[model samples]
Target: MTAAITPTTREALARRIADLALAVPGRVRVAVDGPPPTAPVELAEAVAELLRAAGRPPLVADARDWLRPASVRLEYGRTDVDMFLDGWLDEGALRRELLGPAGADGSGRVLRRFHDAGRDRAFRDDYTTLAADAVVVLAGELLLGRGLPFDLRVHLRMSTAALGRRLPADLGWTLPAHERYETERSPGKEADLLVLSDHPERPAIRS
Candidate 1:
């Protein structure tokens, strides 16, 4: 017989996993509603270690899909079918090309395609397409654990202007909200508390 759906237990497990990620730097666990990335073996290993440290088994998960281009966007609270359709594609066709096998069902095909396509897009497009804010929030909740700070910094390494091009005017946002600007610039075109070092200089080497 199948086990009963235990959302509460799963949530608790999710929390524990996040906590482990916090304890173990350079890693984070995310629970999304669609298929996550399949490449980057290191990412998968890091996630697995986090779950193991939390006394749980790593399970399959999915991330959410963006409905449109960021240039013609809407707030998360708003629903625009036209924009959504623009981002939408035939999942079955996409999956057959990517996986070499038919997906389990229509839902699975769509999710797989979303994951596959998302990895190839620009940073802003990728974040919006995958609702990366949700991933950040979950990671923050896990890292901060309890008594989370009123404000948190989530770093994104790409450039804002480049990323913004993929978004619709209404859907795109400035630093802190969008991944492109979150790391390099804060509210005032200045550096935020968190800095992303794409290239780091060593003191000994420099001197």
Candidate 2:
């Protein structure tokens, strides 16, 4: 009998293995999708480590590296929730430089970082060639439902109260964007792996 697919179980795969390459062949582009307070970066690193242990190369990158210039990002206003949901990330550059190039037929040369949001300037980094079977782990907030091609989509879900409680007071304005994301994108349904991280001590995986 076939195993019922869930967040913790695939047909022939289990949550413990973490050999995600079996799920997606050749070069894989994985999106560690979550809001900022959910800390997608940490989960990304863990995924990379698992790949490394399994003798696969995993290149961890952040979407913040491809953020649009503050001028464009803040055109409507700094706290525009719509802009936060849609316009902040430079998806075109992200596709051109990193995710697109990591595809099966794409050139192995991948651009590591493109833009620096801190100084609001471009990064001075050379292109690095990714191994044929390497995994590109891109972590960031609001990554899903944008039509980006990712082999494995892992969404770190959190409750509204959890998000508000963990998020810093200054960044409270960004909550509406996440709310919009839930209503519009339906990440829980779209994600390949869904993890409920409301309680930091123990995250529940759907059975």
Candidate 3:
């Protein structure tokens, strides 16, 4: 069974993100939890489905890949947070980590490009980084419309079941949740959106 994110851990992460949002002007925060083997594609697909399920506005870009003339792109990878916080690396490292080039550049030119971009942020995990990037993009758009003094937060959690549930159903692979095979499970992280939806002080949706 995948170990669940304990209540304490969730609270800590939430608080950490909340603190970050409060501190950084025009910044966004996001948190995500899921099984370790979750593919990047599965993560992308689930975010798309969740947006639809939640009736969220259409994302400025398609979740599958880059959509257009956007300069800031998001690539997914793990990072050493301390090194990032210490300002040892720049955006180039982050670009290479998040999105370099489609194929291998034998000359490592893309890596050099990433290194040139100037790294302003970093994350410890790929999932969290993806969530943060989505929020950052959304936050930038919101700034153009609503102006500042706002904090944007997004959380994306994927499950082998929930993310890929539609597939097995389509393929006629009928197995109960209890009986289905699960690998690299996160164990306890249930969806937090339901809890937030029930929050009495939940923030109103912004335009």
TM-score of 1: 0.25
Which digits, one per residue and each the tens of the lDDT, describe model 1 over residues 70-91?
Answer: 4334434334443332223323
Model 2 misplacement above 4 A: 1-17
TM-score of every model? Answer: 0.25, 0.89, 0.22
What would the per-residue lDDT of candidate 2 be over residues 112-170, giving only the tens digit for each residue? 78999999999999999999889898888899998997888887788788899888888
lDDT of each: 0.28, 0.80, 0.27
Name the TM-score of candidate 3: 0.22
Query: What is the Cα-based lDDT of residue 89 in candidate 2?
Result: 94
- When 2 and 3 are scored with TM-score, the better candidate is 2
Candidate 2, residue 195: Cα displacement in angstroms equals: 0.7
The C-alpha stretches of model 1 lying farther than 4 A from their native spots are: 1-45, 57-180, 183-195, 200-207
Residue pairs with backbone overlap in model 2: none
In model 2, where is the ten-residue run with the lowest total lDDT?
Answer: 8-17
Query: What C-alpha root-mean-square deviation, in Å, does candidate 1 show against the real structure?
Result: 16.5
